[model samples]
Target: MGVYDKMGKVTKATRSRAEEIVDYVASKGYKLTRIWGMGSSGSEHPTGRALDFMITGPGLGMVVGNLIASYLWKNRKRLGVKWVIWDEHIRSTSPGKSGRWEDYRGASKHEDHVHVFFGTGAYVAPPVAGGGGGSAVKVVDLSQLIEAAERDTDRKQGGTTPGAADDVKIVEAALKAEGLLSARYARDGSFGSLTVKAYSKWQESKAGGSYRGKDSDGIPGRKSLERLGKRNGFKVRS
Candidate 1:
């Protein structure tokens, strides 16, 4: 199935890694199906750290699986891959080496899919260099926006001050990173109606009961921004 459908079975860390792997492999021209599967009792699947990718289409076989698995092993540290099982064999980070392919012996023997597990404290991939045709900026940190907001707050208390355009740009960047807003949404540093709509939609998705009704009224308040930061793997202070 689609990656989104399986995301609820795994932690956000696992979902991010799976999305990256799916995108990387798809760019190389491989069709993937199903990411989350309930493994046997006590398996990593049940713990939300494991995913399975089923490969379909002709001319794809063990050699293809080997190539995919090898690529994952090569980038294990960066991807926080704990282990990978494919074509009846498995390699893991536990030994910090790619072990020889032994007989998997489990059901399906992983002959049709590649399974990956994330390690504790999995790493999140940073934005790609030259992404968005060199026009799209990287995700903005909430702290930077907070600092600017504080400045704007101070200016407002003293005298009539212009709106915080920079804050809007930062929030737009965050929204773009989370796929809540399109790049064309104009990171022009203005908290216009468009920003409000986008921010409100994002808040609705979180729907943690803490920010509802007027609190979810489209303003980029501290609580919503903090939640957004945490969801995107940023460390935010309490």
Candidate 2:
């Protein structure tokens, strides 16, 4: 068996899951900057159930990092993903806390990679589809998007609204494409002051020039969102 993070043999399940993650990233046309498995003694790493895939790409890597996190979360049960950490936050498959991205108090902010832990059930590797499929266009929910944005704005610093990361990330991706938001902050799934400022700039642009003053207050309006969706590959659902 191959060495696990230069320590020793990892469980079949852990090995399979780690391979799948790497393959998945490759299929998306991006590469993981680095991967670590089975090191820390008290953690899942030593037990061979944890893996850390450092993210890097065209722009500081956060975009693909977000994509990987989203994919793992979406397929948590199917892939036996027990827990995940990225960008200073954690999400778990545990009851009452599933899908909730809460602040991570750990020393590592995890901004540069995605840390995943799989349950024992991930023994047999799932079939990994091949080829570089560009980023998938997510279907954005307008109500949830607005709610998430408003809730995020209430925060004094970086934080995400519950159940809002995916949708917010989609919106942020659109904003980034418009050159309004920096890639570094675009994929973290937060709609803080920076996102608000970016959205305002988007509204003032020619494409959304119809909005003015209160209408262009940075909270995405139906028309402006629709227009953005048209240009971005996402569909806005009301």
- Best prediction by lDDT: 2
- Per-residue alpha-carbon lDDT of candidate 2 for residues 1-238, written as tens digits (9 for 90 to 100): 2223443366755655555566577778876655777665446787777877767545438878898899889878767888899999999987788579999988788988788888876342232233475445457888887887788888757688888788888888677656577656877888888998899888888876667798778888888898887766677888
List residue ranges in candidate 2 displaced over 4 A.
Answer: 1-8, 56-60, 124-238
| TM-score against native, each model | 0.54, 0.48
Which 10 residues in a row give candidate 1 its minimum summed lDDT?
Answer: 152-161
Q: What is the lDDT of residue 156 in candidate 2?
A: 58
Provide C-alpha RMSD values for all models, in order. 9.0, 17.9
Over the stretch 1-238, how does candidate 1's per-residue lDDT look in tens digits? 3545654556656665666666677777775665655553336778878777666545556666776788788878777888888987877777656465566777667877788887777344444345556433334445544444344334433221144464456566666555566556635565555656677777777532256787776755666776665544343332
lDDT of 1 at 206: 50
Off by over 4 Å in 1: 1-8, 39-42, 57-64, 95-108, 126-238
Query: Can you list the residue pairs that collide in candidate 1?
Result: 1-34
